[model samples]
Target: MQRIVLERAGGTPVTKRAHLGAVASGNLEVLCEPPAGDGATIVVSTSVDGYEPVWRATLERFLEQHFIAAAIEINDFGATPAMVSLRLEQALELAR
Candidate 1:
């Protein structure tokens, strides 16, 4: 698993970005960082899916100040975004 940590930068857009995730038996084309000329977007695509609002809420809840310069998207494999975030945190902590 790959992870990134974004530092606090002023003038960040705290608003939610247009993001989506899907789970399927087929392979997925994922972009970790933002598109070219668009800067970076934090994406976390998993093999999980189902609960949308929970993940959205998870993103909203965990979206504190230090996470400003980043945008994340997770493709869950039967995993909620909250679970995604929890896994992410654990992964990140382990990585650290």
Candidate 2:
């Protein structure tokens, strides 16, 4: 995972962008950025094309449970939920 943090010297909220995992049939790309006023939000796009509802629900729950303060964009290519979780965790770790 790799991330870039953009912030001034002040204690303002930082903007974070991260890329994790691959773009293969069973990988994902996760990019995170500071939330805009609201709480954590997760948007997932999958190549499979039929799991958006489940992916969004699962990712939203994960973000809320982890108290992640960023907007997450996930580009997934048929990865399972467990794999997605692991990749997300890795990206979050790199962001920190």
lDDT of 2 by residue, 1-96 (tens): 322222112122335677777778888888876767555656666777566566666665665556556666777778898898888888777765
Q: How high is the CA lDDT of each candidate model?
A: 0.41, 0.65
Please give the lDDT score for candidate 1: 0.41
TM-score for candidate 2:
0.71
The per-residue C-alpha lDDT of model 1 at residue 75 equals 51
RMSD over all Cα atoms, model 2? 7.6
Q: What is the Cα-based TM-score of model 1?
A: 0.39
The residue ranges of model 2 lying beyond 4 angstroms of the native Cα positions read 1-15
Question: With candidate 1 superimposed using the best TM-score fit, by how many Å does residue 49's alpha carbon deviate from the native?
Answer: 6.4
Specify the highest-lDDT model's number: 2
Which has the greatest TM-score?
2
TM-scores for candidates 1 onward, in order: 0.39, 0.71
